[model samples]
Structures are given as structure tokens and as C-alpha cells.
Target: MAKYLIKSDATIKAAKPKPAPYRLFDGDGLYLLIRPDGKKWWRLDYTIAGKRKTISIGVYPSTGLSLARDKAKGARALVAANTDPSDARKAAKVKQAEANEAERRVAEGIPLENSFEAVARAWYAKKSSSWVPSHGDKIIRRLERDLFPWLGARPIGEIKPPEILAAVRRIEARGAIETAHRALTNCGQVFRFAVAEGHIESDPTRDLRGALEPVKGGHMAAITEPAKVAELLRAIDAYRGSLIVRCALQLAPLVFVRPGELRKAEWAHIDLDAKEWRFTVTKTDTGHIVPLAPRAVEILREVQALTGRGRYVFPSARTSERPMSDNAILAAMRRMGIAKEEMTGHGFRAMARTILDEVLHFDAHLIEHQLAHAVKDPNGRAYNRTAHLEQRHLMMRLWAGYLETIKAGANVVPLHGRAAA
Candidate 1:
């Protein structure tokens, strides 16, 4: 028989709480502690490094006899290995907590390498710094609105081409054909990024080529002929609309920016004395300088007298707090009998691009730089937004003068690398 102070369950059951607490030792540092209040607990007493300590195993009869002995045995093993049993128990609890957390994460569908939302968000964080605020918002919106519902929790490594195709087709079904194409391209970029990072074996988008409808590319309608451009200029001068709308129409051909950029022009961005309009280009997220010609500057100065106290140079008719509607210029053109097939507000950009390069014979690179068309230098470096400022300043003035001549119905005259006379 094992040596013990109390050897039988009958003896423990027959004992009752007394006026003081006492122990019934089973053996080898294990005992039953009975309190004056009738509570009994299991405990282990041991000595380490010349000091004595105690560890609570549990309360009984909840702990039971055989289970208490097993716990005591495990604690003794720790003490024999020169580890404090209390410290060992604490370490086990910490380890168990970590295991529980990992299991919960698995049950919640989180993983180490394959979550599409995880990888996509990482990629967005890496790239959003170089993009405009609006552009970044659009990227996140595209994923949340169109892709996340279907594939966010799916593993990037396990996502096949069929899943990607289905997500894109759903967007196409909503009549967002252009958005569908853009979403697929974005997916391709993300998949390629994952492959390069070794998170996936290959891009699933590679197998999806030619599965979408081919986009038919067409140019924005513009009056490219010299006579037709002259007529358009004449019509703009004769437009009897709101003062702000007429002014915007007159300035459109001179600056020839995208319609949104022109309409959203703020008084804060223009400097009349400096003869410059400096603002961030919405499409590229880079600073762009529109060197104001005398004619363009005059138009701005006039509009400032009316709207200088407000934020936008062209405030909407409904409220001065907002910029004019994007369709303001286009609607004005229609009212003037310039059909949509003949011209649009965006047509000014094409008109200037064609006339500057083909009619006036200016350097194509100079014209492209002025158009903010992402031109590269001879060294293949991206041109700074302010690059070629001197050339652009002279080009704006000459272009304005050429428009005046065309408005006068003169023959197609080339500037011939000289200032317009």
C-alpha cells in the first residue's frame, strides 16, 4: 500500500468541519484541506531552492479523488525538473489561451496566406499613397460594391478563373460594361501582385482573356476642320445664356481641359496677377499649371468680380456653395444648335490637340505636355507637371491668337515656329 496519512474515502466522509482548519495528507505533498466553514480543497505543498510553497489543485468533491491524484502527479513532475509548479501551471494556462485564440480565428474563416480581402487590402495600402484621394476611394468602393460579396473570404490561391468571371459578369449584367472591364483589370493587377509576392502560384486572370466583350474605342466628337471650328467659335461668342455659362464656353477652347476640370475650377486655384491657374489634375493626382493667356485671364478676372467671395469660380445656378453642373457647357451647346454628334464639352480638348499639332505645326511633345497627357522625356523619365512651363506659356498665347484668326474666317495659317502675328 502507498504510504498516506488518510487512507480511506470512508474516513474523509466521516470527518466534519471543526472550530479550526486542518489537513488530511494523502502522500507526497498532496493533502485535503478542510476549512472551519465546511469547504474542502485539494492542495500540494513542496520545497524548492530552500523555500516552501503551496499550489491549489482544485476544490473537491468537484475535483474528485482520482482526478486530484493525477493533477498532483503532474505538478510533482514539474517540481522535480527544477520548475516551480505554480509557474508551470501559469505557463500552461497561457499556452491554452493562445491555442483557443488560434482555433477561434480558424472558425471565423481567417487564414495566413489565401484570403482575397486580406491580400487585396494589403495591395491597396501599398499603392494608395501614389493615387488621389478620390481615386483611392473609387478602388475601395469597387471591391466592396462588386467583388467582396462573392470572393472576399475566398483564398487567393484557390480562386479559379470561373469565380472571377462570374463576379465580372454580374457587374456586366447591371449595364456597367465599362466598370466590368475596369474591375477585371484591377483583379488582374491584384493577382499579378500576389503571384510576384509568392502568395499564389499564378494569376487566374491570365486564363480569362477574350472572355469579355471587346470594347469599341471611339474619339470624342469635335469640330476638327478649320471652317467648322471657326463656326463653333462664332457660335460660342453669340451664346446668350447665363453670364457664367457664356464665360465657361469662351474659356473652354482656350484652355481645352477636361469638362470636369473646367467646371470645378475654384477661385482659390487661380492667380490673376501671376497669370496662372494651378490645381491638382483629378485624373493623375499631380499638380498641373495652366499658364493663363491674356484672353483667358481676362475672362477669369471678369467672372471673379461676380463670384470672388465663393469657392468656385463658376458657382451653380441653384447654389453658390457648389460648382456648376458638369453638363452645363454641353447643354449650352445643344441650345445653340450644335448637335451632340458634332461637338461635346470634351470636344475642346480634341479640337486643340488636332489644330496645335496638324495646323500650327507645334512640337507634338510640347502640345502633349501642355495637355497633361503623361508625356515622357528623352531619358524616359515622367515629365514633371510643371515641366516645359516656358514652352507652354508661349503655346497658350499663340493658340489663343490662332483661335482669334479662325473666328475671323481667315485661311488656315500656320504659326511656323514663330509667335502668332
Candidate 2:
């Protein structure tokens, strides 16, 4: 039993290829295999559990005689411990791969794939496309600010309802009862997503019903009184801000669409000739048609002269590629000395809902339909976009005329259901 038989580098290099594969033994189950293709490979032959096995150590010159011997020594040690050298090598490779994956995830600020944060992020990425940008932003921000800090690192499957309640309690403690409820709802959506993806057994949020404080008076402040509404309209008409923002403010009450929808209005969706603004309502994922009143069309036409060729009807001042900031109209109102307690961008909806029903005396269903709400029919089916097109068009025209009369400081009396055409 000669040991280190092919010792020197010179002898190893001198060993030429053979007609068939042949080995040069170096004792202790280590050998150099020379093939007919003129390639040399280091191999280790060992027996584990009375079964013979061979594993590759390295190649010829690059591995060198010394390095191959070191690798062989390690393999032999594993074999002595009743482990198969080939199996040990495979297990080590797998362990190294797992370590690399973890390191990469950490570097990217991504939690473990099965963690609550990771699954929630995955859900957000999947669903946010259908949501308005502001709404999507709120969901991710809520998760990061309220829930991620506490439960993000925990495995999604191991999280219980109590842990979720504890995280939402922090949001409640800050007096954001509405936001706390919203955070809980968002978490439920994420958990249900996890359940569908097989990351968790069930949604834990379903277990914690009625656990938080009820939201007290979450309505946006609005001026529903006719006199105050007239003053607001006059102020909006005289807004000394950018023409684009002023138009948005003036149109807000007339059309009464959501602020996000107004700012993100695209030129492609507006048809002045048809006197309609068509867009997908992101909240309900439904197609919506806003039959532009004569006044609303006039406002759009005036702004169209400035932004006709762009993607957005009212683009951001800094860049035309995007819409105006969500805060643009609100900021303009604040600049005009309208406090948040007095009015907000969203307050227009409440204002219109009240005025259209109270003073104008329009059909409640038509008002709700015009508001793009989920108005159902007699059979419990939801009304389509153009359910009462003729009446709505007439209603919008009258509503615009009424606003003009009030803004002129005319003493206007309520139509009291006489205005519905």
C-alpha cells in the first residue's frame, strides 16, 4: 500500500491520457483519473456502510496535488463519521445556498418569504395595480407604520389574532380609530391573500371582531347650508391660484368626483364633444361616466387650451407626464384661507349629496348614481353607468345653473322637488 504515490507536480503533469480512463492512486482512496479526452480529474473513493462510493474532489493543475489532498482528507473524515462523502457535499451546498438567499433578502430589505411582512408586501404588489395611487400608497404606508414594526418578522402562519390586535392598538392609542380600523381591514386582506397562497392556515383578523373603539364622526367637513355653499362657490370662482388648480376647485363641487379621480383625470378619458368624462372608478373597479354639465364643459375647455396634448388633463406643474399632486387643490383652498375644519377636497361630495337632495330636490337614486355610488335596482342588481342618462344630464345642467345664481348673490329659493326635470 504505497502512500502519496504520485507525489511531485512534475510526475502528475507527466502522466498522459490513456486509451481508456485510468487512475493514478495516491493512497487513502485519493486518485487522479486520466481520460482519453486528455482531461484529468481528482476523485476520492471511500466506503460508507459497506457500500463503495466515489466523489469528485477537483481538477488537475488548478486544484493542484496539495489542495486535492486536503479536500480528500476532509471527505475521508466525513466517511469515518458514517456519513457518505457525496451526501455531505450535497448538504453543504444546500446549506450555503440557503445562507446566500437569506443574505440577499436582507440586502433588499425583504423579510423572509413566509414572514407576515413579506406576504403582505407580495399581496400589495399583486393588488395595488387596480387601486388608485393614493389609496395604494395609504395601504402600504399603513402596514409599514402600524403593523410592520410589531409583526413583520414573525412567520405568517404563527401569528395569532391577539398579536394583530396588539399592533392595531398602537394606532388606536394615537387617536386614529378610523385608521386603526383601516389597518385591521388591510391586514385581513393580506392574511386572506396569504391563506390563498398557502402561506398561512387562515386569516387571524377574522377572529378579532369588535375589538377596537368605534370610529366617532369620520365624515369630511363640508358646508351643506345654501348660504355657506354660495359663499364657497364665490370664493372658488375668484381663486387666484394656478389656472389648472382653480379650475379643479371650481369643477369639484359641480361634478363632485373624488379628489384623486379629479387630479388623475386623463385627456384621453374626456370628450368635450360628447360632454362626458369617462374613467374607471378605482374604488369599485367599475366604469364611470360623468356627464359634464355646460359649466363643467366650459371649465374643461378652458384648461384644455393649456394641457390638450398631454396625457393628463391637469398635469403636475413640475412635469406634464404625471397628474397634479393630490394636495394641489387642497393646498389651494388652504391658501384661500379655507381651514380643514371648514372644507377639504373630499368635502365637495358631502356638499353635493346634501344640496342635490335638500335644496335641488332631485331623485335620491339619481343623485346617488351621479355620485358613482353602488346604487341598486329593484331586483338587487347594481345600476350600470348610464342607468338614467337623460335625467342625469338634465339634473347636472340645473345644478350648474343653480350654483351660478347663488354665486351672483341672488336670493335663491329652494326648488323643493320642483327642479327635477
**Predictions in order: lDDT:** 0.86, 0.89
Collision count for each candidate, in order = 0, 0
Candidate 2 segments exceeding 4 Å error:
1-110, 417-421
RMSD of each: 8.1, 7.8
Per-residue accuracy of model 2 over 278-307 as CA lDDT, tens digit each: 899988989998988999999999999999
Weakest ten-residue segment in model 1 by summed lDDT? 412-421
lDDT digits (tens) for residues 1-421 of candidate 1: 2334766666677669989888888988999988999898999999887899999999978887788899999988888899999998899998898678657767886633357877888888898887756668998899888987888878799999999999999998987777888899889888888998899888999998888876543335888898999999999999999999999999999999888889889988998898899989877887889999999999988888899999999999999998899789989999999988889888898999998988888888888877888989889999898887888899999889988888998876575673321
Give candidate 2's error at residue 253 in angstroms. Answer: 0.7
TM-score of each: 0.64, 0.72
Candidate 1: where is the Cα deviation over 4 Å?
Answer: 1-145, 170-176, 189-203, 206-211, 339-342, 415-421
Question: Which RMSD does model 2 reach against the true structure?
Answer: 7.8
Return the lDDT, model 2, position 394. 88
